[model samples]
Target: MAKYELNTKEQHFATTRLEAEAIVTEAKEDKHLIMHKIAEKHNKYGEYFLVDLTFSYNTPKEIMGVE
Candidate 1:
């Protein structure tokens, strides 16, 4: 099983890639939101996130058996 998520000041979890992407698109378009640094992290469980270190926004797309 895998999961996806979008994070800003808050963490938003999604069940599919499409949903996650939608969240990202929305966040990018939100003028009230500040997006500075973003990073991708791969964990042992194959879960990864596009993260902003300060507020720590994590967009995670998990694929089974993938690093």
Candidate 2:
């Protein structure tokens, strides 16, 4: 996969992503126990776009404030 580098300004609007997974014996279950690993990346102040990577199971839990 190709990744775009993060610039300084756009870093402020960055989102969080991490490697995580849920396991369940049944596949049809609507929900599985969700767990996330502890890892964080800071967005720089000069970047023009958002974060540099896309990930799985990544969602906005809450929007705290604007950049």
Candidate 3:
């Protein structure tokens, strides 16, 4: 089995790097968010690589100053 980690401030997990990349791409394109960073990482766990993503956008809540 393979595991990957994704982060957009919060964290998500994927089974493959491609899947994680897809998640970030779709969010930026479809959802119109700004992608700050996209990367792949490998740790001591072995052959599996983790995908990391960072993005940002202004939400209606932020504009409205909701708390």
**Model 2, range 1-67, lDDT digits (tens) per residue?**
5333322211112232211112121211424223212234344643222322222332333222221
On a 0 to 1 TM-score scale, where does candidate 1 land against the true structure?
A: 0.37
Report the lDDT tens digits of candidate 3 across residue range 31-59.
Answer: 53444344455667744434444545555
lDDT of each: 0.49, 0.26, 0.53
- Of the pair 1 and 2, which is ahead by lDDT? 1
Highest TM-score model number: 3
Name the runs in model 2 displaced over 4 angstroms. 1-31, 46-67
Q: Candidate 3, which segments miss by more than 4 Å at Cα?
A: 1-8, 30-32, 47-67
For 1-67, candidate 1 gives per-residue lDDT tens digits of 5454444364565544565566677666655455533444556766444533223334343333245
What's the CA RMSD for each of the models?
A: 16.7, 17.7, 10.1
Clashes of 2: 11
**Model 2: lDDT of residue 5:** 34
Q: Each model's TM-score, in the order given?
A: 0.37, 0.17, 0.40
Off by over 4 Å in 1: 1-8, 36-67
Ranking by lDDT: 3, 1, 2
Better of 2 and 3 by lDDT: 3
